[model samples]
Target: MLKSLVVMAVSFLLSTAAVAERLKDISTVAGVRSNQLVGYGLVVGLDGTGDKTTFTSATFRNMLNNFGVAIPPNIDPSSKNIAAVAIHTDLPPFAKPGQVIDVTVSTLGDAKSLRGGSLIMSPLKGADGQIYAVAQGNLVVSGFGVEGADGSRLSLNVPSVGRIPGGATVERTVPNAFAQGDSLVLNLNHPDFTTVRRVSETINSLLGPNMAKAVDATSVRVRAPRDPSQRVSFLSVLENLEVQPAQEVAKVIINSRTGTIIIGQNVRVSPVAITHGGMTVAINENIDVNQPNPLAQGETVITPRTGIEVDEGSGHMFEFAPGASLQEIVESVNQVGAAPGDLMAILEALRQAGALKAELVVI
Candidate 1:
C-alpha cells in the first residue's frame, strides 16, 4: 500500500511538470500594456426613460448653445428622451491612429433605461488628461424591463448599460519603451524563483551563455538585436519557446460561503487521530383525558403529557500516518463518511494542532 501511494504521488508530480507552456502564455513584455480611456457624454432617443436631474438639463443647454441655438434661462427643455452617460474603453497596446475600439456606456443618473439611444460625440481621455479617441455610436443594449400600473415590475438583464462595438476611433497612440531599451524584460504572470531560473536557463540554451539573466523572481532580462525588424523576429522566437514552470506551493483552499474545498497535490498531513460525532434530542407532547367512571356529576378533565428522548451517534476515530499524501487524507475522510462541514472542522483542527503541513486558506 505504501509503495503504491508513493508511486501515485510521484506520478502526479511528474504529470504536472510535464505540462510545458509557451513563454507568451506565462510572461508579458515589461513595457507593453493597454491603457484605459474614459469620457462623459449624453445618450439621446430614449422613450420617456431619460434622466431628469438638473445637471442633465444644464448639459443639454450647453450642447444647444454650442450649436448656436441658445435657450432662455427661464425655460427648461425638460427632455425625457435624453440620458447622461459615461463612456469607457481600453486602448490596446500598439493601437494606431484611425483604428476602432469597442466602448461601454452606462447611465449616470436615475434613468430607467438607455435602450434605443445614440451616444453624442465625446472625446475619451487617458490618465495623462490627453484626448486619445472620439466615441459616437448607437448603443446595443441587451437587457429590458417593464412595469405595471400597480407598481409591480419584471426585468431581465440590466437595461441602464450598453456596449458599442468598434464605436471609438483612436486619435492618439500611447508610447512604450519596447524599442528604446538595449535589453528587453519579461515579467512572469506568477513569480517564482525556480521558474525564473528555469526561464533564464532555457533562453541561454537557445542563444548561448550569458545571453539571458534572471533579474529577479519575477523578471528576466534578455539581450536582443538593435535593429527594429530583427528585434521583432528575435522576440517572436523567444516568446514561443516552451518552458516548464515550477510546482505550486502546498495549499488547501476553502470557500467559506460555498462550502467548497480544494486540496493541492503537494498537501501532506502528519500523524494524527480525530473523532467526529453528534448528539440529538427530541421532545413530543401528548394530550390525555380523565373521566369520572362511577360518579355521574363529575366533569371530564384533560391533561398534557410530555416525552423526551436522547440519542448519541456512534463516533468513528480515524488516524493518519506520518507524511500522508493528499489521496490518503481523502480516502480516510471518505471511509469515515464525513460531510463537508465535518471535514472542514477536521481540517481546521489539524491545522491548529500543527498536523496539516500546508497553508490553509479560507476565502
Candidate 2:
C-alpha cells in the first residue's frame, strides 16, 4: 500500500499542466519573517532519568540561589529527578507582548527521557543577546522507552525531545521596516526571470504603469502608500492577485537507495535504443565417503565433488522515438520489464550518450 502511494505521488509530480497561483503562494515580503530565539534551561520531575553531569549540578545550585536558598560550597545535590534542557521558539512577525507561542525542549545533558517533566521559567534570547520571551510549561512527550533488568531496552520515537504548545509568552517586539519604507519588495519562493517579470506585469496591470518593477530574477519592487493602514490594505489586494508562474526546468530525480525514480514532465528522450539483461551462476558441492572392506584396515576417506552452471538472461531491447514523452518512456521501460536499478542504469547511459534531454540527479 505504501509503495502504491509513493508511485501515485510520483505520478502527480510528473504532471505538466500550467496553473495560475496567487502571488502570496509564490512570494514573501522582504523583512517580514520569523525570528529564532533560543535559551538554556532545565526540566524537572523525571523518573530517575536525570543528568549526572557536574554542570547540571551547578545549574541547580544557581537556580536555588535565586530562590534565596544557599548550599555549602562543598555540598553537592545528587538528585535523579532533574535534567538540564535547551528551549527554542520562533517569534513570528508582528508578535506583541503577552502573545504565546509554541516551544521545543531538547535534553542538553545525559538525560534518558523528558516525559512527564516540567520546564522551569527560562528566558529566550535572539541573536542580539536580548530577551524576547519567557517559557515555562509541562512538556508533551510523544516517545518513551523501557529498560529490562537484563539490560534489554525498547524505545519508540524520541523521548528526549518534546513540545509545549503556547508555552512562551512574548515580552518584546522585533521591529520591522514594513511601515517605514515607501516601497515593498516581494521575494519569489522559486527564483525565475519569467516569474518575476509576470509578477511585476500583473501588479502594474492592476494598479497603473510604473507601480511595480522587476529588480532581478527573485525580487519585484513595488511602490506602496506610506500610511501603515493603506499599506496593509494594498498588500492584502496584491497578495490575492493571480498570475501564472513559469514552467519548471526539466530534470530527473533518482533515489539510489530506495530504488525510486522521478521523471519530470518536461523530460524527453532523443532517438535511442536500450537493451537490458542479467547473468546468473550456480555452484554445488557434494561429499562422498569411502569405507574399507569389513576385514581391511579401519580407515575411511572422504572425497569432494563440485558442479557449476551458468545462465544468460533474455535481453530485451527497446527504442524511443524522437522527443518521447514521459508516458511513452514509462511504457517502453515497462514493456521490457526493467527493474528500478536497470532503469536507472539505462537513464544514466542515455544521459552519457547525450540522448536524455534533462538533468539527471542521483540521490
Candidate 3:
C-alpha cells in the first residue's frame, strides 16, 4: 500500500507538469501572423464638437451623392456633429469570410472628441489597396473632454480615439503559403543559437530522428506529413512539447527621452569606483535709501547691493568588486546617493571606460 501511494503521487505531479505552457507563447510559426488593415471614414453624432474643415464637407457631400441625395453645388453644409476619422484593425491569419474583428477609430480632422459617435460604413483595405473588410459601429470612447472657456482643457485619456469590439466584417481572406511545403519552419522571437539547437533536439526526440533541423539561430525547420490534415496534428503535438530555452544575453537599454534606465539581470560590472555630488546656488538683492539727516540738504539717493552664496555638495564614494551583478550595481549606485540622471551619466561612463560587460543601447 505504501509503494502504490508513492507511485500515484509521482504520476500526478508528472501529469500536471506536462501542460506547463502553450507553444504559441514561445515560438511563432512562419507565415502565421496578423496583417494590419486601415480605412478612412467619418464619425457622426458629436455634441457640437466635430471638425470644421472643408474636407469634412466634401466627404459629407460625397456620401449624400452616393445615397441619391443631390444637393446644390453652391451650398456647403458644415455640420458641427460629424468628424472625419481613420479606422485601423488587424486581420488575423486564416481569417474567414463573415468573421468580425475589433477596430480602432482615430480622428483625422480637428474634432474635439468622438464620444457617443457612430462610425459610418467604411471599407478596410490592405496594402495592396483591395478591400478586405468593412467597419461600422458605435464607438466606445474614453476620457476625452473639452477645455474651459479659454480653450484650456484637462484630460486623462484621449477621447478622440475609440475602439469598437467586433466591428469589421472580413469580406475576403488573405493568401498564405502555409501548406505549400512538406516542412514548416519555427522562428524564435529572440535569436539564440543554443535555443535553436535545443528546440530542434526536443522535437526530434519526440517525432523520431531528423524530423527537425536548426537552419539558423532564428529559424528551425521541421519536417511534417505531406497531408495537410496530418500536418496540422503534427504541429499541434510539436508545439505543446516543452523545451527549456537558453538564458538571455547581457545588455542595458536606456530611454534617453524619458530618463528611464533598464539593466539586464545578466549584466556585469568590473571593479570600479563612482562618486556623485550635487551643487546649488542662491542669490539675493537688497536696496537701501539714504535721506539727508533731518535738515542736511542732500539729494535722496538709493543704493543697491547684491549678495551671492554658493553651496558645494558633498559626494559619496562606492566601489564594486570584479564582475558584480545587476543587484550589486543598483545597490552600489544608490549607496552613493545617485539620482536617475546621475546614474545615467555613470552608466555611460562605465561603458565608455570598458568596465561594463554588456551592450549599452541608448534609445
lDDT of 2 by residue, 1-363 (tens): 333443565577655256789999999999999999999998999999888788889999999999999999989875778998999989999999999999999998889899999999999999999999999999999999989999999999999999999999999999998987789999999999999999999999989999999999999999999999999999999999999999778888899999878878788999998888888999999999999998987889899989898889898888899999877887788777777888899999999999999999998
Candidate 3: tens digits of C-alpha lDDT, residues 270-350 = 999877788889999999998888678778999998999988889777888999977677767766666667878999999
Alpha-carbon runs more than 4 Å astray in model 2: 1-16, 283-287, 291-294, 302-307
Candidate 1 segments whose C-alpha is farther than 4 A from its true place: 1-17, 279-312
RMSD of 3: 8.3
Candidate 1: Cα lDDT at 301: 90
Report the lDDT of model 2 for residue 131.
Answer: 98
lDDT (Cα, tens digit) per residue for candidate 1, span 1-363: 333443465567657765999999999999999999999999999999899888889999999999999899999976889999999999999999999999999999999899999999999999999999999999999999888999999888999999999999999989998887689999999999999999999999999999999999999999988888898999999999999998888988887787777778789999999998877899999999999876588888999999999889889998999999877887888777777778789999999999999999999
In model 3, residue pairs whose N, Cα or C atoms come closer than 3 Å (at least 3 residues apart or on different chains), thus clashing, are none
Best-fitting candidate, scored by TM-score: 2
Count of clashing residue pairs in every prediction? 0, 0, 0
Higher-ranked by TM-score: 2 or 3: 2
Query: What TM-score, computed on C-alpha atoms, does each candidate reach?
Result: 0.87, 0.93, 0.89
